[model samples]
Target chain A: MTSSIHPTVRLTSQQRLEGIWNKRTYTIVRLIGEGARGSIYLARIGNRYVALKISQDSSVISAEVNVLKEFKKVQGPPLGPLLLDVDDAYISHDLKLAFYVMEYIDGVPVSDWVKREGLSWLFPISFQLLKKLHKIHQLGYIYGDLKPDNILIDRKTKQARLVDVGGVTALGRAIREYTTWFDRGYWRLGDRRADVTYDLFAFAVCLLSLDPHVTIHNTKERDIYKVLNQAKSLKPLTPILKKALSGQYNNALELKSELGVINRKQLQPTKSNRKTATNPKIDFWPEALGLSSIILVHAGLFYFLFYRI
Target chain B: MHTGTIRQILLITDGCSNQGEDPIKVSSMIAQKGIAVNVIGVLDDDQTEEPVGLSEVNDIANSGNGISRIVYADVLSETVQTVTRQAMTQTIQGFVSKELSQIFGQETNEEDLPPETRGEVQKVVEDLGETVNLQVLILVDTSASMQHKMEAVKDAIDDFILSLQARTGDHYYSIYQFPARNQVVKELLPWTNDGKRVNKVFPKLAAGGITPTGAALKQTVKAFQNVPSSEEWRDDSDDIIDSSYGSSY
Candidate 1:
């Protein structure tokens, strides 16, 4: 209930979230945003800064935590760098809440930066976004929601990274939710999700926000009007994009493709789109080729200093 | 180091995986010498279209996931002298994708919530309001570990996107990626299930860069926006999103 208490920082009660970490520290972070299915935080652990989140309940949180643990086990060093040091311990809070900590982000959202810089955030970072999501999906968990904010783009490196991952919908949850409504589909014991299709839809919404086209609408309906007009607008894919764009057939796949539906493939343009991949005609995310992995390494070092500020 | 060869490799290609762009064949072929069978599928057109890999001796025919069809790749290896030879065959499981999931596996329906439960759900939801539609930001490591997993992730996300389309509410999604270099924001697809021209746009992706997760996160957050709506949304636009240093591993 608005976190019965206020976060130590004057960050305002965006919904104060304070919970226990190791019995000695009861974390207090200002609520930042409502993530996938719960609350997010910009917390202060003693003198250090972190982002925290508490999912709906212990069961759901456990599933996500378990997935996170699996992730901690399998991911490469460059993928979602394991942030939180998860623990199951009794806390200062009355209710036993599931909490995890992550490095605190210090920059403004790309949206604000776009508005501030007054430049199009599209075409540069958008395509690369899909590639990242595809990798996450490969890791065997659905991001459930893929949006700009969930993605943090470093100004120095100009690359994107994913965060706020506590909400992972497993196959069990999907089966539990759909047993009655749909009389079809086989149910697996610990499957991913029966309806991961929704991630694509969210992918579309995320893309539209970055695409300069949807913003031009300037109406309450926003992109809805353009979505309804998909019958006429979406011309055939442009040559190289043809490989990524053309998908499915007459059934729902064709329909999804035709409507410019945002799927994982459609979002991540390949090296051909890069400058010197020999396919110069297709200028996908050119900035990607010129940059180096060193930037993230530096960002890691820089952020360590930035967080201190 | 333990080295094993794959007797047969199966790929599900919905056009995500390149026909001959793979480097896993050596490992697989080596595994073949040990009489190991590996199945890979490259999903073609829809989950049903024929894939080229299905004909590579041990490959199975083209069949997409989510359709309830299964493709089987069986490998048989015979060691002759010091060398080993393998024979591979692919089979398709003829079953409606949904029906294959077995019976009564749907999620439990949310019956009229008991008053207390309803009240609690409503309170949390009300607290969330417009922000209920959270966003997902993706970070992909195009490193050596990223090769085979790339296409699989793309396919899984494609299915996930299709699944989220059924619900209502204003949800928005954006994509950005990094390897050694930074890729641009290729496409911004909005969340509208009207179907026609839905912007199912996946870019032509390949991996080359080192994993730059932190930089990628900053690049993505730079595109984040606070949609103006009358919901209990927390406004940090005034303060804003930051380039937080973090990674999944």
Candidate 2:
């Protein structure tokens, strides 16, 4: 369905959209972000806030709507922004625009959350994000563009919600969209297929980016590997990062389990007393027995020599 | 930020640099940061004044340590695949030679090895090629004079991507068309593996406006500068690297 609106048309605040399914009118409060394919807006329906995504390109909007509808059908824990309603509006005599409404996630991006709330939150946040991804993977879909911007973290709820569902691709399909930094293809580690391991690799990079000490940039492959390997904050995650970077993981759940283990190990207190208790004792009987055995062996050797002489 | 792997900027234009920073200087600076800049000059028939851009293209490619090819529009598809693959092969060979020198006591070039050894090395190189991430930022000139060449460019890009996919499954491509209707250079497609995605933007790529080759080059460099951070991580359960290392030992 081509929108009557020109592909370059931009929506302004206070613009109203009536849902085709529910017939609920949503007022666009403000523009959230604009990308090449579409624009996301903060919309208000009565007193409740919802995210209104409007795009001139029908295919882009259709892909997002299809994925959202599929997720809604599965009815599991919310993996991303919930799809509220979708409709097409006539902007002009010759132009029509497609729009969709989703649950508005009021939170900061993962990167900002880390900077504000401290890196300690990354462990729990990462675990939550992984669980979400596992759910999506179980449903046979992959969050193709798994990046800090696409992920929003609720500080109080401690839930990381995936935004921009346009990039989500079905398992085994070529990933439709991706940021070069998070893409294994960009790193030359693997193909751009929507598999569980793809998300796991991006998740590893996400954790690596959380470290203030580690600055991620586009460089030579060797340099990137070196940076990942030498990242001080990622030292504990080095083995995991290397595997993920090399496309070793089966799914996000496996990564989550390992991350949990690492986090728990780091959080546990060191046992100094136990270490001291395991020290060798100064028992004289064993020492004497050892010495006596050595003397007896020497005596046997002497006797053999004397007999030979 | 350092994008791990060799970053390649492939600028395919049919006109000269008319605005902003000199393409050669921009490419030189990019080269200094270990990025390779390659240029493909698409020439049209009946315009034989040796488009001034050809000299700048050669200089830019030379400065960036990449190959420069000037081909007529009709042969662009085949030549594009060849030029890009050649550049990629050169990069892989350079990396392999460096790695070999580091691992062994002697410095050896890929060509110097015997046939059997070379085959093994080639296999390793191909394997490495799959893992070594590559970003190809294609800058296409979409000026009015170049209108007839867009389809050919699209076909060439399609073929190029297919050949690349066969050689190494890991490759991300982004296309930026210059003298864009609204912007100096519009992103026809973001970094993606799916070539069909470009079809959406190709039909709408009207050839008009001035060819701001220099400004587009400057903008292309800026786009490369904005490398986003990766948020994904790997699972720790399987220590593939460790197991491989142990087996080797």
Candidate 3:
């Protein structure tokens, strides 16, 4: 177990750890990533690939483990990593570390996926993430951190799964951690208390981030407002975004309903076809008539000058 | 990523400028480009005397529209963090207060804000701290006079880094030591988040040579110019200045 003070332990491929609680032997394949909390590793249990999160912060790990334990009991569509096992391992004679293994999610980050698949998937991905948040909110939990990096989308399934559950805050509790760009609290539009609306706000930011046209360089209040106002891609969902940003939406369900409307509107061919068809007609007829009148006037003037003279 | 309004340069020194162009003049030029330049003067603890460059530090900070502080070397580790935090808070507050004035009209004061609004303001400030990719270009003086205070300055810097990380968790630092053996300013470390890596350079940074504060400031400004801003997706009609904005740091 690595001491909580110095949590970063370099692990090599094929290293093994015997789960103290489950007595399951897992072989590490490679390090997937590292964060302030600790490191994540891709490990194998027999033929299955699983994700192992090892951290020296016992309290943080305990909070996540607790949340996952509670979250597992809630019956719904799969929302995040499925907890498989939790245990402690001794790395040295005196050092022991807490770790947990969950179902491995094989997918690229949502932002990368959006870049590959295009903006058409933005609504669906956001809708799915919202649905997940709605479910979590119903279970009395809030995903405190909902950023592009925390969400993974399986390209084949078009399924979005959230990672880094450590920041999950109990409903009505102060949020534990969050990325400032996605956080409404950072925008000076809302507080940090965990609720469905907080997640909705972050979801709105997540959408904005995935939309290549919407660029956010600073989380300053005025700057965020400026970016949101100027984002052409977000024009269709401006009202919803405005409401979400201002903390008007009461719940994820309300936000999801609004996004569903946007989804339907985006998919409707008639509305867009009508727009394209009417624009040229409105623009061309006046120009054509004006040109004809001008030409007639010129011809008449020439005829009068020649015949009258 | 440099799509924001806040840009800052932190200069830490122990002595006056004895070579190169005028420091205050250079600071004013940086200010004209909308970059705030702050100065921290480290004083000798053993001697019962004022730091030689205190007045210049104040002048430079004033010209740059920033803050200046002077502290004994022994107390630098404790005060440096506070000074930097104060500078950042003040810089952000300037923007936030202006915004508040716009929203509530020019007559409004921060104290008169509603409790909920005040809380929101606090969160906004914290958010800016976290989201703003702050690039701190630290200009350290390595003149022979700074030798006695070098150890204390190093410790102070380490504390400053930890405090910054703890407070905002979003900052990138670059170190430029003035009056190198051969060059006017030496790049001790490139931009990085690893404090330990930055600490490694301290032992190797021997304090000697004339203090070319002006040349060092100019070089630091040039370093900032070399960093490319994040590529933005903009329509031709968009007229915002593309030079500085976003989290390019």
Candidate 4:
């Protein structure tokens, strides 16, 4: 695995640009997103552009790097960012920092994109994105911190890139949360992301959140309530990710082989809105109305004849 | 009225700031030059009635960085800054007492636990030993400060569950950790006998939720409902006592 760049409490300005400045590791030309956790920078290596993430804690950095490494080792599924390079090394006695490079498509965060170009444009890409997350689980590392901020969207291509593995745990400490199976040693379904199925659930939540009609801004009461409810209800991955999502389906390769990266007929919403049947029973309606109208006409004819006579 | 020169009177409360006494002003005035007084603004739910008005004081109390919010209880709605600060002083005294006990472990026959409390704890342990229904409902505080604390609790609970299970030699005991949030709003997983499964669920319990002790208790009681209760178990004070007001964690 490529060494990832890590953050530290101590580091000279020059040393901070070790692999970042020079062509040896990366060529960080511009800064990207910044949040409470860390910062992301857009950099270049050879002709390809990449995203670089710099975090504070070493464990966070390790968790992220390990996830990417694990994903790559398992030849991860095709949903999120592909790990390219890393800067996993200590700069000094006091400073423990690390970071890594992702396939940085020149894109903005999906939420920002939603704010910019209304919700109508969210589909296929959003669907593809959720489908990709399922692939991530298949690859076997929980996107421990699954949120809009972590997942970046390529504005031009409308593709989603999954990033940030910091909060993830392969074999980690007790975060003591109560779940159905509370015994020790046995992997609690809540604690670890053993399979891709759970990630699919999260992906579903992500998709529903991105829905144009819905307003899922933060982790507020409404947001959590709606999203978690919607997530638990999602039926299956779109036909694209269906093969891989199925029970008999084994290996991430089968998905790519079955369906290419992009669908030719993109899922864009049109004005001819398909009225999804919400258990509408229209069979008796037309006949009942027509019969009523016929009876009324006949009665009117009979009344007219009787009045004339 | 020489109640011994008060070094620093800390007011750790949820509603003190709301009660016309500005926590920031008070804490700042005390912390500036001479005295080392502190004032804390607890961010508790208003439904509890105790945390009202105090949420507003967070900015001011944390302003000078002199006064810190020491301990804020979940689920109660009363402004408890006064009570909390008083408890804090008591806590300090308790700590000093503990230190003294440690130093004079052999010499001092210290009275730490009240006779009644000791008897209750003894009864709980003894009751636990009797039937081996070792139900360890681990209510972990998943707030930011309690991350390390959670780690400790997980370890302790793990060890405790292991020891208890070893004694009983059955899949009986369980654990349920609650992130500091009220159930009226949202709750994490409820209680279960899945201590073995905690290893996976632990990381999912990240910090950053409001403390809701009532909800936690309600959830805990719900967890207990799954465990088979007996007349022997019902006769104990734990069974007789109501849990709604008791959950301070």
Fnat of each candidate: 0.00, 0.00, 0.00, 0.00
The best candidate by lDDT is 3
Docking class of 2: incorrect
- TM per candidate, chain B: 0.37, 0.77, 0.79, 0.37
**TM-score sort, best first:** 2, 3, 4, 1
Instruction: Answer with 1 or 2, whichever has the higher lDDT.
Output: 2
Please give, for residues A219-288, the per-residue lDDT of candidate 2 as tens digits: 4352447668546655677887788777788888788788777774442112422332222222222334
* Candidate 3 iRMSD in angstroms: 17.6
Model 1 stretches with alpha carbons more than 4 Å out:
A1-29, A74-81, A88-93, A114-121, A155-157, A170-201, A215-225, A228-309, B1-249
Positional deviation of A105 in candidate 1, in angstroms? Answer: 2.8
**True-vs-predicted CA distance for residue B168, candidate 4, Å:** 20
lDDT of 1 by residue, B1-249 (tens): 111111111122212223222323432332222212222232323434344433331221111111111221110000100010001100111111122233326532111223233234332332222122333323333444456555444543443333333223233333333444345222333323332323243344556634433233333333333322213222232111111201100
Runs off by more than 4 Å, candidate 2: A1-9, A19-22, A92-94, A218-223, A267-309, B1-249
Model 3 C-alpha lDDT per residue in residues A1-309, reported as the tens digit of each score: 111212456677988888665688889999987865678999999999999988754434555666677778877767678888877776556666667888888889988876654555666677778888888888888898888999998655657888888668767654666665776655646666677788888887887776555667543343566777756655788888878877788888788888877765553223323332222221133334567889899999999999999
lDDT of 4: 0.40
Q: Point out the higher-scoring one by lDDT: 3 or 4.
A: 3
Q: After superposition, how far is residue B187 of candidate 1 from its true place, in Å?
A: 46
Worst 10 residues of 2 chain B by lDDT: B232-241
CAPRI-wise, candidate 4 is: incorrect
Cα lDDT of model 4 by residue, A1-309, tens digit: 011111222333224334422224555666666643356777666777777777653223434555565666544344456777655434454443456678776668876765555443344345555565555555444454455666776665556666555434222221111111111112211222233433433443455555443454443342233333433212222443333222234433444344333433333432322232122132223334567889999999999999999
